[model samples]
Target: MKTTKRVIVLAVLLAAVVSGCGEVTVESETTSTGSASEEKSAVAEKSEEASKASDSEVKAEEPTAEESAAEQPAAEEPADTATLGEKNALASAQNYLRFAPFSAQGLREQLEFEGYSSEEVQYAVEHIDADWNEQALKSAQNYLRFAPFSAQGLREQLEFEGYTSEEAQYAIDHCDADWNEQAAKSAQNYLSLMPFSKQELIDQLIFEGYTREQAEYGVSAAGY
Candidate 1:
């Protein structure tokens, strides 16, 4: 009876130990799984924070509308400002040309003398509406009223006044002044200024750019 009781006690102790070992193993496995889950969550949270931080930095780097405009090149003046300047220049040029004839260069110089800039002067002169040929003709007529001139002399005077050679020739050809009568008038004016012999006056008329025949005719006509 004693031997049987001891065997039963030993078997019961073995079974109890086996049950405790199984519980310990199950508890350890549960803890390991929980720790792994916690580690994964921490990694995901860090990734989310880094992503949000990157998004914020990108937004901060972008420029606003005003800042973007400031960073680019400066814009030009308003179109109206340029247009107004041009209009003022044209008006000033018209006023100047209304009183007198002007060469293209002379007009530009006159505008500049009035304190307009070179570009403005250029714009004004180029836009002025005047017939250059008609201007030359008027200038020639005015000169003839002051003094008699040979055809060549008149052309040279017109050229000196800034008319082109062709324009000067055009004016001379168009003016209906009688060359012989102009020579006679010039001789009379000269003799009125100073006493001269017939030969001396004829030579002087020739020197004044009259033709030899015109000079002879003028001295004879002057009663010299």
Candidate 2:
């Protein structure tokens, strides 16, 4: 009977210890589950707050494309009016024509460089007269003063100075000075300085300005 009482006490003690262990395990599981739930709730709240802040910032920002375009400066327009003195414009036009006879377009561009308006340039060039005929006449007179050139030779010189065919012809027709006599006299004067034989004198006279016939007559007159 004592052995049976001892066995019963030991069994009751074992049952109490097991019950205590089971209660501790249950409390631990509950604490772990509650901590996990609280952590998840805090994380969710933080994410929602961050999302709201981002939305507010985006709404506050200005439109980048429109703002950039508006902030850019405007392009400048070209000036309509041109400035040039009348005398300067006229001088430039004359210099441009001296090199060669220019076409209408070429002349316009030249006048523009001197700062004249298109209308003013055109008017100036039209009114400013270039006397190529007088220029040719001057060249002919200058050439004849040095040596008496043939009519054909004078015509060539005139054409070289920018005179027209008609103008060249006019200069030849209206030459007031008797070139042939002048040529013979010029040759005779040169021969007087350096005497030559009849044939040699004729050659020098012809070279100076006299025609072949005039050269022969000049030598005969000079007592060669």
Which candidate tops TM-score? 1
TM-score, per-candidate, Cα-based: 0.59, 0.38
Q: Per-residue lDDT for 6-105 in model 2, tens only?
A: 9999999999999999999999999999999999999999999999999989977856888889988988897645345655676777787676554344
Residue 44 lDDT in model 1?
100
- Number of clashes in every candidate structure? 0, 0
Residue 7, model 1: lDDT of 95
Query: lDDT tens string, model 1, 114-214?
Result: 88887787778777877777778878888889999988789888888778888888788888878888899999999999999998999899988899999
After superposing all C-alphas onto the true structure, candidate 1 shows an RMSD in angstroms of 13.6
Alpha-carbon RMSD, candidate 2: 15.9
Distance from true location, Cα of 182 in model 1, Å: 1.2
